[model samples]
Target: MKIDKGISLTKVELDRIEANFLAAWTGDNSTPFIVDAPISASLRTRGTAIVRQTNLYTLFQLCPTLATWAVLTPLAIDYGASNKNVYSHISVFTNKNFDDAQAREKLKERFRFAARRIGLPVVGNQPTELFFAPLGPARSQLPDMARAFVGAALHLGPPAVEDTPSARDWQRRAVATRCPNLTRLNATISFDRSAYCARRFEAWRRGNEPLTEAEALLFAAYDQAVIGFGRHRSDLVAPPRLFWNGFTLALEAEPSQSAQSIKLGPFPTQLPGGSQVAIRTPWPEKITWTAGSIAQDIEVAPASDEILVFDADSGVLLTRTALETKVIAVASERQVVIASEQFGVTSFGPSIQSADPGRFIAWTITGDELNFPGRLPPWDHITSRDGALDQCRLDRPRRNAYSFGVGWRVDPQNRSRCRRPNQNSPRTIR
Candidate 1:
């Protein structure tokens, strides 16, 4: 398909995708780890995870900040540069299994009509539909599961579902209809087909035990994760936990000597009598797990000795949210994360009700939404003022220095300001 147009559709697609990329510069030592920020074009973000000769998983973690455009632009070019005639990149997620050819064609027609209305091409490229095969006998659906997660990153806004009573009711029914158990995995220690690694991993995850084998591996070759698009992470020395006093969602951890992050549930559940909560990989850290029935798994490193807050409100993993609460710091080994005053796990668990045994993956829900499915995405809350892409900006201003307070940017001048990298926003996060 050749066209005499003002600009190539490929260029249009790249602009649209990059428009949603949110980034900001931080204070003096704000984001020291993103040292390659200036050279993201040459950044190698993906890796092969293997042992001996076994390819377990493909691991990649790319931040969505301005620097990341170096990586995305080429991929967009390649995709659009393909045999033109259809918008193969756009896809829909569904778990339905079609049985009849007639039904399939009808659905295809309907799908294409929707696509056309949205200005997408009708044919000549990859298949338009992405099917999430239902869990067969032993949960043979990791690839499908991973695709849902990766696909999820492409969308913005609440699902068409509303907060009305009927929506909540149906969502409740859906939740009750159990999805199969997430395959249990032990990426670390004594893992063999007959390794009993799952049982041992659970034991250690719940109750610390004296280990006889080599220190359990922190992650497995099958493990993989991607953190970006406004998400952030920090390390903590203590165990990660979500406890609630009703007034606020509280995170408390003790000081630990170990210098690594702890792995918590990719599984979700909240505390006793508290707002819905779950453990996630602390920010900046990413891992993909063959054992994960969901998107990715996290290991909280223990070096920083400060616990960071993660926002599950939007349903995206490890993204940032406003730290509106108070933090309190106490004596050695004892810390309270209330409100700086800045910053700062628990078991592999459900902390679940006894009545529900079949569910391994509990979702993150809000207090007022009444146990409905998750609404906000990790990046959805980030809104551009002009109601388009790239315009989303978070500008944080001055907080006094020396307090170790409100520092999140870097600049050429006072270096106290933060601005969205690629987007045209003067706002900074400090």
Candidate 2:
């Protein structure tokens, strides 16, 4: 329980260490198993069940096939009088019976240890991502993320558009306000390690040394098929809400109420290949989307809500502080202007330099925080340019400063201290 100060680790770090160990040796997402959703519904998989190749115990004599080595394995075991938390039931369904009120309630939610390899799921690298869901790869994003008057016109400069998440699943926190009906289902089962194997792991835990390949050969890979039923729950009845269809918008099933503002934002939305997304709302509702600057009451039913759809526009949003004025630079005879990539957004350029389009004196910058770091009170500026990147003509812009608006939180807490970002951030004519 108590380790040397030097080796003591935070809970997250300790879990990470165990996860790495599991991934290196036991991260086999291919093992076959089954689980019950409700008491009546069962889920199964395809793979070779883990079984011992050789039998050395008396079970073979008593009943050759009926009492296989797997049958004899204990669910858990202990040695000393006190072995507090030696074996963890991490992410396993402790209560497998859904019919029992208490058991189902207990099964309602169980934390998954970061070491998912200990459980029997072939999870990919990111444990945060779930393998099973009703949806497939999302081709869209949420829409209009600016914390300020997002659905309305600019309060300061332009609409602040932030970075977005894949439309596969909405973030739980952001979706909470929309009051969407959410159903959760968990499966109960632990098919990776046996009680004796866990006891061995307890011993290994002290030494902090992994088993040698030859040492590992002595252990047997085991499996079981006694997964019981888990649990499920639905959200409380609430206001009508809109669901991201991964490409557009759809109304959730709810008793229709007239004149409701179905907020479609707080998440930035986008479509693949930069195609326009047509928002489809439920038919027969008098919809009114009103913000400070723009209020549109459009009732386009049995049809996509193109003009009224919050996520409909795919144009790059300039920040509220963005300049209303415009600056145009014309490139000719191999001379060019440029826009560089930032914040995962792709970009192109008129090259003072050239990959293939030829070269000229590249458009210059005063400063770049990311690509080029500046010094002395950190004055960011372009000293020279072999080729040019757009948007660099201003700030000596370190990427942090460049990203200040649009997606960044930009110190909202300090809004009272400094309201509008007083910067010379400029955009090029794309």
Candidate 3:
């Protein structure tokens, strides 16, 4: 069999090759001597069992030099089962007790030279490094002989050469080729829609181009909905106010030049078993009040420009002040009386029980009467108009003090009349 150019195996070498093949096939573990024969022919004769045994040692022994063995190992394995045992054995045995760094450098040089000999591109410094050691998993590197064979078969083509352009450069080129008019200048890539619009607006401003119809609509909608008209103005015509009603007016108060300083009197004496309390101005404005508590019914009476909160039973004054304020009187088992000028109040306490949960009344007097300047509806005839109110028109006496018509009325004919079940008895309204 022809092993290389101008080299032919004699009868003795072919006999030795067949003997090693039969020995390995019969499971002989003895180290078989090498024979000068084509690895392909030996593989066909012995099958994959050649590499699974010590037959690879026979092939390496027969080869003239490591270079020849390197170029033929992969070919033999490819013709066999492509099992890694042969390659692994080659790596360990050849490099045993050898300097790893020096051996690696030599193998790399030889592999590159052999690849170039086969018309492969040997570009850049250490181009062999791509397929050599450290590129794949550790211990993946085969012996010098095995690497030379596999490298030639696997990487001996133009496709194996590393291309010059980066992935980003190729992607940009592809986009430009597909859409020639697309410009990336001053463009911002963002996941946020607001940021995208802002970037688009800035780009349009820098380019000095008229806004597209879609861009104009986007800007107008964003400005009117998210950014109020007072703070931001869009270049496009303002969007029509679809829900604007004349009754809903936006009122902006003028900033006060100076805040009024309110002086408060001493707190009223605490009741027995009362808890210690601390009160401070709810706002940054300098205002103080006399902290106090009261039991029994409390009455808030407005006199001229001043307001007074006093106990109705004893007629003792609790607070006398003039300010837009709110009063909260807790009439539960434990009473907590608080009067504050703050617009909002937050309270905490144990849940209270009531026979009629909806009968409880808490009123807020904001000093402004909410008036609809129009003729009022006839609430007495509401049952005739709305079927839902028919059940409420029973002739029986109203048991709930909070039932309709007690504190509400409709002056449909510009006349008001109080309705009481027993007006002659002089019932007191609480």
Model 3 whole-model lDDT (C-alpha atoms):
0.25
Q: Which candidate number has the best lDDT?
A: 3
Specify the poorest-scoring 10-residue window by lDDT in model 3: 237-246
Better of 2 and 3 by TM-score: 2
Count of clashing residue pairs in every prediction: 36, 26, 2
Q: Residue-wise lDDT of candidate 2 within 141-257, one digit each (tens)?
A: 111111111111111111111211111011222222232332211110112111112222223322333343222321211100001111101111122233223333344322212
Q: Point out the higher-scoring one by lDDT: 2 or 3.
A: 3
Q: Which stretches of candidate 3 lie over 4 Å from their true place?
A: 1-41, 44-90, 93-98, 124-430
Candidates sorted by lDDT, descending order? 3, 1, 2
Q: Tens-digit lDDT track for model 1 on 1-430?
A: 1122332234343333323222212323122112211222222231100111111110011112322222122222233244322222111112133356664554455544433222222342223121110001112222322222222222211111211122222222222232223221111110121112222322332344423211122111112211322321111111233332222333333232322232335543322221333333232232222111222232322222222222334221221122221111111121112111111011111223211121112222211111111222122222233323211111222321111213222222344333344333322123
Q: 1-430, model 3: which lDDT tens digit per residue?
A: 4443345555575456544443332222111111112234545444333323332334334422223233333422331234433334335433322236675455445545543332222333342232221111111211221222122212210010011111122223322343333222111111111122223333332334323333343334433432332322222211011110111101111122212111323543221211212212121111131112101111122223232232333323333333222121211222111222111211222222222221111112222111111222233322212222111111111221111112221111222344542422321111
Residue 75 lDDT, candidate 3, scale 0-100: 29
Q: What is the lDDT of residue 53 in candidate 2?
A: 20
Q: How much is 55 displaced in model 3, in angstroms?
A: 17
Top TM-score prediction, candidate number: 2
Tell me how far the alpha carbon of residue 178 in candidate 1 is from the true structure, in angstroms, after superposition: 25
